[model samples]
Target: MKPELLPLLTCPSCRDGDLTLEAQEEDALGVKTGRLACPTCRTVFPIADYVPSFLPEESGGERWREAWSYKWENVAEQVRYSPEGDEDFERKLNFGNHFSGDFRGKWVLDAGCGSGQDAARMASRGATVVGVDQSRGVYLAQRYNQDTPHADRLHFVRADLFHLPFRPEIFDAIYSNGVLHHTPDTRRAFDAIAPLLKRGGLIGVWVYDRTQYWRLFETFWRPVLSRLPRPALSAFLHAVNRPWHWIYRYRTLMMDKVNPWPESSVARHLADLFSGGQLLYLLTDYHLHLAHRVEDPFIRHHHAFDAYSPTFAWGHDESELFEWFKAQKISVTAISPVRTGLIGVKD
Candidate 1:
């Protein structure tokens, strides 16, 4: 870690300014590696392979841990952009472009970066990227960038959202997509990083939406579904989720048959796929061991945490978020093609 960056960091746990670097251990390769501890909190966050781990302890359980187990690269690579396919990376990237405002020549921070995919895209677009996550997923991010031609412009680190190690004004811009909502305190997590931005520097974050319907789903299902044990609950969900898939197909097939339009193909397909995917994702990944180890090593037990972790499942609507961001003096640039995705810029 840079010595200058250390002075600017406060303990994310106790909000204390006092911290000390206690030890450095090197392997046979003689690489110096260790963690810095907060003198007040006595929390030991890991610093491995030069990346500092700033995330809070796992008291909130495995939601963040499980979600982050998917290597950043794997998550990024999963996005296959197809101009012709019903669903493609290009379409999502097109929607994602709203968040990439004026990123050229900037030092960008990919907060809550599950697998350095977004960071790689930024680097490809000419931004110096820093990918940070609390999980062991950074290893994949490091390896992903290493193989890239622009590896010099990309760096991966293990850092907490509330306890980032960078100095204030270190980044030219920061954006976190599909993160923050997973943390225990979403507002505090946002507050922790707000000060780190340069004056007038860009900031955008895409969190889960909390619309009226979404609220009902959370109130009724997320809480109840998250209560059951992984094995038993997963089995039960797999059996029950079949109906949702049937409904999705039935709706799409009925819609296409009644009013078939070329333009409607994408929307209908997306609706159908999302419906099926959500249930499967919830059942296999969160409730059972179906998605285990298919993508990354650390992710074998990913969804098991989500089954019972409420902290990782919170969300909010765009109107409420717009008001909050406006109060902070941040401007809303776009809400993305998906209502769940939001983009903002700092004044």
Candidate 2:
């Protein structure tokens, strides 16, 4: 780790100045080249290759090992389907006034870094980022980030949210976009990562916006869809949604008549080309959709045990969220109502 960066660090556990960095050797997994010890807490954390391991235990253990396996299984496809086009960028811009200034040398933690897409974005902006994900998402992240200009600064690990293996108070900023909600206990997940932040560190989170549109789908429709086998449901979606794709691909008058876009001819033509109704449906099954270990018989279940476990899928109202944050006593610096983006700073 850079010597200049050391002064900005503090003990993640004690949140005091009693911690000191010890020169330690890198382990087999290239973790914790040094140690950060908190005399107050008697807690020692390892820093691997300059990236601290805040996890309480190993990344791939009992509770979250399956998540890593799932990430490894589907990361390539997930990255491809993630928002990558002009529309996606627009969506991210809509999220809050995050990163209005340069982040050229900031140390950032991308919590729940699914497939490392957001991590890649932060790195592109010149941030030295460490992306942590429970799933084997780190594998794909490492693969995608290896050749970049900031590769030396970018790192990843398969880790749990509850027991992060990182030194406390080391990160300048931490962000988790659309991730905390997916955990078994969202509040616990939030509590786990929040303690690791430095006093002045920024914490930005983009959770699933509680909307009627999402509710209609996630609550009523998704449960119904989750009942079927994966292959059968996927095939059914592909078949039924074929017409939408056909109309989209062909731009025929009849097809447009059935699935209307807008009154204007040009608008109709454009919608047919770009509208993502069918593709969205297919993605619902494979990506956003979840099964209670029905798809994979092996490994432990994370979300659903009875095939209908509620888990942490609960959505919060804006007022409820604000009150929760108030209870935490964190200062809200910026709020973006458009994307339901909430950005805060720890005092």
Candidate 3:
């Protein structure tokens, strides 16, 4: 961690004054290794690989941390070699669509930054970004941005959303995409982060929408899949994708109503032969799995694991989110065209 970041940080345990740095190793660049000791509690937090670990002893569950850590560790390679066209452009566009404010010279907080891709994007645009996450993904994020020209403007901290280590109202803007819903209580998580934004500063978040399709998956499949052993669950998901792709490729036959069900004795056989039983997995794996429509298998697996691995994945409609922001005294600024992305200005 850089010495400049010391002023913004506080003790998460006591919310006290700035932590006193006890540098174990230092370089011309800054503190390469150290321990931050809180003045009040005297609790020491380790700073390794230039990322501060602010998580408590038993913060993120083992499986939760492992799943995300593994995903971020490998995602860079998957994004680099995959046939998917320009993941960076997609990320930039997604950020632009949700976050309306000018980022130039802004101090932004990327709450729950997964791999620091978005944080790097913001830093590249002249914004100083503090990217925080609860998992070892903070290491991936720090490594991803360490060599960039914007390295000076980018910072990574391992911390929980519910218990951020920064002083209140320190950020000019905050953007958290596809993050809060994965927390145990999405509403409480929003409340926790809202106070960190300065008055009139923008706060944007994109979460899973409670559509009819997601409702079914959440009620039935997610509960079971989230509990399964990671390896077995991943393998099962990968195995299911094969037939899902086959069905997606031959969806025309199903739409054409070839050998309509119940009327014909050979309906099942026809469906399997022509559409590859598309109806059986249409909502769960075809339509809901947006990657099925794309050509990249790595992207497919990335999206699949992202959707299924998390222990707490909730879905909310526009009204619930809008109400939450309104209760926080934040004025609604914009809701994305998809209605899943919300941006608000703090009052």
Candidate 4:
């Protein structure tokens, strides 16, 4: 990692000891292989493939981490922001109004940064970004963004959100999107990351909106689905098909299976472009909600698995999110009208 980031790194175990980096391999990109040792707790975090992993082997192999690690690696290619454009990131972050699209000369933390997509986006805009995830997604993300224009400014670390390795008030801004809810306690997860932001720094977060009608259905199905082998479960998600889905004719399950995105591209894109935020959960089995929205049937399957396989999927209303900001002494500035997107500044 960058030498500047070394001083900011603390021991996740002790939360008091500063980490010392011993690089075995180095490049212009930064530390390629190293060991970050904590003198106080004697916790040794390993750096490999240009990414430091604070997650132990046992934790990496846990049920939930396995699911998420698979989830991200599956969609790593599809989720890459096209130079053409990707509006979802802007929509999620409320880009221009909250803090503007420009992030030059800022230090940002992407808490639970799955696949490191958002972190790369911030880095592209000139923010020095540190992305942390407790799963193997960190390695996948490192590989995904390694050759990008802003790779130098991006750092991915595998660490528990509950026990993040950083000094207090180290980040100019912090964001957790569609992540905190998966933790045991959403509020506790928020509390853990809130202290990382500098005073007056902006924090943007998006949690699941409790309004998804299929919430009960998903809750009941997860346990049954999660029990199957991940490969088996993934295969099952890909096989789900409903021919009589779209109102417009000509694009059917068989058509998508043969050739993805391009054949049914026009109408599907139009439908999703207007489908609003809760597009992933409109129908009983997500046959309609995610049909036109996601790029192809492949991505839809991943989204299905992402929604169904998570151990904890808590949904919260705006007031509950507001409470998170209020408790942390953060002032809510701009909130997304569509869902539970909260943009606020620490007081």
Candidate 5:
């Protein structure tokens, strides 16, 4: 953790006291190991692997954190964004219209930063980014970005979104993608982060689109999968691996019967082969099991783990999200092409 960020932190325990750092180790990167002491509350937060961790204790059988932590743990490769993915990110956040893209002198916050890939990408754009996640995934993200070109610009913390350890209205911008829906109350989660953004700061989020055909199926199957013993879950993932891919590859066609892209002769032929298996289509998305798809050491498991593993996976429409921004006094700026995500600027 950087000493520069010490003042931005407050005690999650008391929600008001400023934290003092006691660095036990330091390196060229920053404080490598330390403890953050909150004088008023007498609470302590630890810094390790270049991150100050404040993860709330897991209780009430909340296993989503474990699922994401497992994802980073098992993904042997540092997550990469293909060129297309970079473009997709731009579109998801409506960059040209909302953000200058050159983030010099900006303080950005990445809520639910997994593996810190986007944080690194943002830092490379010259923004100083704070990546926070409730899971141990923040540690993985912090360690992964330590050797990155703009490593100094990336800081990480492990804390529940509901109890982020920061003062109000400090960040210049904030984004949470494919994350808010995972919380127990997606809107409340949004409420938690809204206060952190400075007025006029841009904020963006992508939630699961309620239009997806699989929401109901996922709601039913998630409990079974999430509660499974680790070994059984692995077996379950293996069992569905092939069909899962089958669905992913065909999800586009499965989503719309009238879209012409799926009307090609070859696509029709493939569709015919699986005409009787609509059930398989809704069961896909395995998040990360990597390096084992037909024996590729790095083949990632399905995003299905992402879908069904979390205890809360809410879906919402654009208007609903717009109301969230309205209540927060933010102006809706842009919605992604897919309508599942949108960006807003604080008024």
Candidate 6:
């Protein structure tokens, strides 16, 4: 962590002020190794590889932390050696489009930054982004972005969303995409980060929407899948992806007939058979909406793992989320055309 970031960090445990840094190694670049000490609370947070660790010993959400940490560690080499080029950049642009103000020269907080991809993108756009994640993905993110032009502007910290190690109203903007829902309580996660944005500062978030079809699937299958051992679950997902890919590859032939739900019993039985009768309802429902857009086998499997691996993956209702923002005294700025992305300004 850099010496400049010391002022922005507060004791997440005690919410105390005047955090003192004990720099074990310092140079022209920054504090290479150090510990942030909170005198009032007597808490010490270690700085490892220029990233501060603020996660508590008994941090809740252990399932997600373990799953993402393992996932990123395995993919770190792939991400660093051969980064996703245009496809990645396009996704970042789509994410940034939800925000209200320009990011240039802004102090942005990327809450739940996975592998630091979006953080690096925002930093490349001239935002000084502080990316925080509770998992070991922070290390992967740091390594992945180490060679970028905006590497100095991007900071990684291992911190939990419920207890971030930053003072209130310190950030000019906050962007959290496809993250909050994975936490045990999405609303609480939002509430925790909402206070960090400066008054009038914008915040953008994209979360899974609780569509009726998605709700039905999640209600029935998510509970069982979430509890499965990692190896078994991964194996199951790999097997599931085979059929998913097959369906996508031949979607042209089968999609039109099944795209519109069958009105007759015979067609319904045929649709069920075509879906392999394994997760019949869920697979058919998902393929109907997304099979045409399925590209990149790696990303398809990655997203499949991401969807079912997390212990808590709650989808939100648009109106309910907007009401929550209103209750927090934040003015709604824009809701994305898809209705999953929401942007609001702190009042």
lDDT of each: 0.58, 0.56, 0.74, 0.74, 0.74, 0.74
Which portions of model 4 miss their true places by more than 4 Å? 56-61, 75-85, 241-290
Arranged by TM-score with the best first, the candidates are 6, 3, 5, 4, 1, 2
Report the C-alpha lDDT of model 1 over 208-288, residue by residue, as the tens digit. Answer: 666623244345566665555444544564454445445544654665676544633666545644545434444334422
Q: Which stretches of candidate 1 lie over 4 Å from their true place?
A: 1-32, 35-45, 56-105, 212-219, 228-311
On lDDT, who's better, 1 or 4? 4
Angstrom error of the Cα, residue 137, model 3: value is 0.9
Residues 130-239 of candidate 4: C-alpha lDDT, one tens digit per residue: 99998788887788888899888888888888878889999999988789999888899999999999998999998888886556566667778768877777766655
TM-score of each: 0.65, 0.63, 0.84, 0.83, 0.84, 0.85
lDDT (Cα) of model 5: 0.74
lDDT of 4 at 20: 88
Residue 6 C-alpha lDDT in model 1: 52
Compute the lDDT of residue 102 as modeled in candidate 2.
75
Each model's RMSD to truth, in Å?
Answer: 7.2, 8.3, 5.0, 6.6, 4.8, 4.1
Per-residue lDDT of model 3, residues 161-189, tens digit only: 88789999999998887788888899999
Evaluate residue 327 in candidate 4 and report its C-alpha lDDT on the 0 to 100 scale: 94
Q: 309 in model 1: Cα distance from truth in Å? A: 7.5
Candidate 1 — which pairs collide? 54-160, 55-160, 71-115, 72-115, 72-116, 73-115, 80-89, 81-89, 81-90, 210-316
For model 1 the local lDDT of residue 196 reads 71
Candidate 2 residue-wise lDDT at 136? 57
TM-score of 6: 0.85
Residue by residue across 215-321, what tens digits does model 6's lDDT show?
56656777887788767766776676766666645654565565676534566646754665335424322433443364555555555566666788788778878
Best-fitting candidate, measured by lDDT? Answer: 4
